[model samples]
Target: MKGISYARYGGPEVLEYGELPDPKVGPDAVLVKVRAAAVNPVDWKCREGHLDGILDAVFPVVPGWDVSGVVVQPGVSVTEFTAGDEVIGYVREDFLSRGTFAEYVAAPVRTLARKPRNLSFEEAAGLPLVGLTAYQVLVKALQVKRGETVLVHAAAGGVGSVAVQLARHFGARVIGTASEGNHDFVRGLGCEPVEYGDGLAERVRGLAPEGVDAVFDTVGGEALKISADLLAPEGRLASIADGDVVGYGGRYYWVRPDAEDLLRLTELAEEGVVSVHLSQTFPLERAADAHRLNQEGRTRGKIVVTVEWEVEPAG
Candidate 1:
């Protein structure tokens, strides 16, 4: 099968499209014929060898995590799904496994859930990593409550878009930071849009006189430190980006995937409480171009790769 693989870490140019042997399915895994795969900042970070100490990658790694596909073969122990079931999931990052960039991938059954009935493969492909990250930060770590006011940085990006919607669904009023161009877009997601950069804290203060109940920082840097000051006393703060640790009074969190959290996000999508926004799609062979676009960091939402394949009818 043709897939994107990198034998060494460097720039996006290092990624190449080529042939690789099909993955062997395990007893608790399912072999999926990938329909679409989404790009995350983590993909590039991994590609550049940024996660060296924390995540050891196998040479010639396929770099993607979120995937939407149909199950072509189920493991002997898997009873929840059969061949031809449409599913979406976050492949484990630990092994640096061959991922969704390929025409096919083997995922642990527990990592996947039935794709939302209302979504297309491109849409479902954008949800797993970003959706789960947002869900976990708001519902699990911060425990955002109804009537609370929450602040989200980089509100127009993939995870930020989902975070804004989920916070509003939980009854919390949301304030999101994006450029002026996306103000209307963020507002449409039930958030008050603020311009990000210097004086961001002042802009937020103008909106919430009493201070925000929680802060979800997706653009970690000076923004993370500034977000801490925006927090109300006893407020919650979580960062999904790297180097976000700060001595904030609120809880500090880094997003990690749990099968349970993915299940919750799946339910939210199925119920129409959350929506996935896919901004762009590229063919599997253009993985390099996909990475370059994501590195630019200006996309409105998720970027995905479509793998050509035949979909069996749902039984």
Candidate 2:
């Protein structure tokens, strides 16, 4: 199978496109013919050795997590899906040994979910990691209730775009920070768009007047440091982008793939309660280009790598 791999941690230039042996599935796993895979900051972060301490990689590591595909084969013990089923999932971090930047990848049946019927392969590919992160933060970590107000930083980025929409779906009046160009876009997600940088607090205050009930900070820098002041008394704050979140009195959520959550997101997508917006896509061989665009941090939504031959026939 053809895939992209890096022998060592470095820049995008280090990635190479080549052939590798096909993956072998375990009794509880399924072999996915990857149709499209999404890129996250973590992909490049691992590429550049930023996650060296937390995640050790073997040489020639395949780097991708979010995937949407068709099941080409199912493990002996897998009962949830068959060879032609459409699925989406976050391949385990431990399995970076064989990542989604390949023609095929194997995942535990427990990590995979039926892809949303309403989404295309490219759009479904954009949902797993970012969608799960947003769902966990709002529904699990912060327990945001209806009629409250929440603020999301970096609202135009991959995770932020989904987070803003999900928060609003849960009945929170959402305020999101983005550049002027994405103001109308964020507003379309039912959020009040706040221009980020320089007096963000004042701008938010001018819009809400009563302050926000929670803060979801995807741009963790000085913004994370100042986020506490924007919250109402005892309000929660969750940062999915790992940074120094020590004093914020809220949890730092590192995303993990939960089949249950992915299933729920699928239901939401099918119901038109939430949507996945794919900003761009590259062929599997051009994994370097996908990483380069994501690392630039200007993407309005998810960037995906499409493995064209793996796409399933339309239902």
TM-score of each: 0.95, 0.96
* Candidate 2: segments with Cα more than 4 A from true spot: 310-315
Evaluate residue 84 in candidate 1 and report its C-alpha lDDT on the 0 to 100 scale.
86
Clashes of each: 0, 0
Cα lDDT over the full model 1? 0.87
Candidate 2 clash pair list: none
Position 275, candidate 2: lDDT = 87
How well is each residue in 5-28 modelled by candidate 2, as lDDT tens digits?
Answer: 999889999999998889999999
